[model samples]
Target: MGVDDQSTLQPMDDTAWTFLDGRIDAVLTTVRAESADRAAQGQALTALITSLG
Candidate 1:
């Protein structure tokens, strides 16, 4: 979707908004899950490093 003006707000279709909202939600969920997994792995690595040292 392209915007006509930066300052002016244009009316958008309800269905378009709904579709965009769903897509954004899916992206957010995926990002959150990946971040959680990365954090857990980092904690485990830190624990292992401390034990080795």
Candidate 2:
């Protein structure tokens, strides 16, 4: 998913999309780790993970 400034710039290229995927995966992994370690926060994490989907 790419957004352009001023709603006019071109979409990101394939390499940029790959980089975005890597960053997104890193964030998801971090969230999952936190969720595993904090049962009380599972609901919030679930919401975040679901929203990502």
Candidate 3:
């Protein structure tokens, strides 16, 4: 779940993938938080895409 605006130079490693789970968890948490706070789906989705980026 890691990338830069520049070219993909340094390849991703296995260790980096391990942290991907936590990143996904955080994105879900943010989505839930937005819903709990009555935020619009658009806002939640924005957060989701931002996390993936």
Candidate 4:
């Protein structure tokens, strides 16, 4: 779905979050230097991860 398609998104349960977080870490480890857009995305994901705690 598109970024603007909020209607299709739903919040996951705590169990799902725990599962996804590990997978996300695995994917994130492969990430390297890129453009400012990726930097912005990293910042935003960091904020979301922080909010879950």
User: Each candidate: what lDDT?
Assistant: 0.51, 0.53, 0.54, 0.54
Identify the runs in model 1 with alpha carbons over 4 angstroms from their true place.
1-11, 34-53
Which pairs clash in the backbone of model 4? none
Ranking by lDDT: 4, 3, 2, 1
Model 4 ranges off by over 4 Å? 1-12, 33-53
Candidate 2 off by > 4 Å: 1-12, 34-53
Model 4 per-residue lDDT tens digits across residues 1-53: 76434333334355655565665664465454353356655765675576556
- Candidate 1 lDDT score at position 21: 50
TM per prediction: 0.42, 0.41, 0.34, 0.34
Residue 15 lDDT (model 2): 59
Can you write out model 2's per-residue Cα lDDT over 1-53, one digit (the tens) per residue?
A: 34555233324456555555555565566666734645435555555566556
- For all candidates, what are the clash counts? 0, 0, 0, 0
How many Å off is the CA of 40 in candidate 2?
19
Residue 49 error, candidate 4, Å? 18
Instruction: Output the better candidate (1/2) by lDDT.
Output: 2
Best by TM-score: 1
Worst window of 10 by summed lDDT in candidate 4: 3-12
Instruction: State how far residue 34 of model 2 sits from its true place (Å).
Output: 5.5
TM-score winner, 1 or 3: 1
Q: Clashing residue pairs in candidate 3, if any?
A: none
